[model samples]
Target: MPRPRFWGEALRDDESGSAALEFIVGGVVLLVPIVYLIVTLGMIQSHALGVEAASRHVARAVSSAEGAEDADARAAAVLDSIVREYDLDADTLDVDVSCVGDSTACPAAGETLRVTVAASVPLPLVPPVLGLQDATRIGVESSSVQKVSRYWRDG
Candidate 1:
């Protein structure tokens, strides 16, 4: 049999596998979430990029609309395209277009138009069931502005 050890020797002997165990447990508890956070943030950023593009396109579309009557319809169509392209839920996405400087009619000539796109992206590695109340969904929003052509006239 091995010689009996002092208290310090017993303590050192018990620690042989503890480091590896702690490393594994700590890695699972911490490293996994860190990785998931990075991936989820990346996904959220990508969705934000899509929203920004959609906002820019919608602003351009509204700024170029020939008449106020057709502008809303055209803007709706563009928003629909964004929803389809981004695979966003209709209920979770909202778009707003407005004109600056006291212009009631959006896209008024020589005015600046702004488009805001807000959307929710499901968190990466999260279960859909966990997002039932949208707690696991991240909101991504973007706004874009475009100036109407001074020489243009609304029909």
Candidate 2:
């Protein structure tokens, strides 16, 4: 013989599939932010790598160039190509080149050339409205140094 439950008692005790439902709801609530965090970190990391590569390559190009003009051209070309390849926002890109030597002029022969590339990476899915895009940006910068040839020439 089985005992029959009243409607109120049955409803109160009825938790058969509730675990799965609660699990689903709890998972969704926990997962959304985790996914967003992963996406944000991924974007920042990619931009950081891009900036680092840009600085390293630019320094190498400038150091290996034949002359001042050649160095400028090479640096510009490398920076531009990296920007495009990395999908970095050109408007946010800034490059600084300096020489570590007594010479006032940059890219002096036998000097170490330093190149810095910096950019602001916006968080993924940030809206453009109300300046949120600009407000939520993360700044990434990288610098690289390369020594010019001691016999390097200036034209």
Instruction: List candidate 1 segments past 4 Å from native.
Output: 1-11, 14-20, 69-74, 124-132, 150-155
Residue range 1-155, candidate 2, lDDT tens digits: 98987999989977777898899999999999999999988989989999999999999998988888888889889988998888899899999989877778677788998899999999888889999989999999999999986666876
- TM-score of each model, in listed order: 0.71, 0.88
Cα-based lDDT for every prediction: 0.79, 0.90
Candidate 1 residue lDDT tens string, 5-24 = 89997787785667888989
Q: Estimate the lDDT of model 1.
A: 0.79
Q: For candidate 1, report its TM-score.
A: 0.71
Worst 10 residues of 2 by lDDT: 100-109
Measured with C-alpha atoms, the lDDT of residue 128 in candidate 2 is 92
Error of 2 at 52 (Å): 0.5
User: Candidate 2 — what's its lDDT?
Assistant: 0.90
lDDT of 1 at 115: 85
Predicted structure with the largest lDDT when compared to the true one: 2
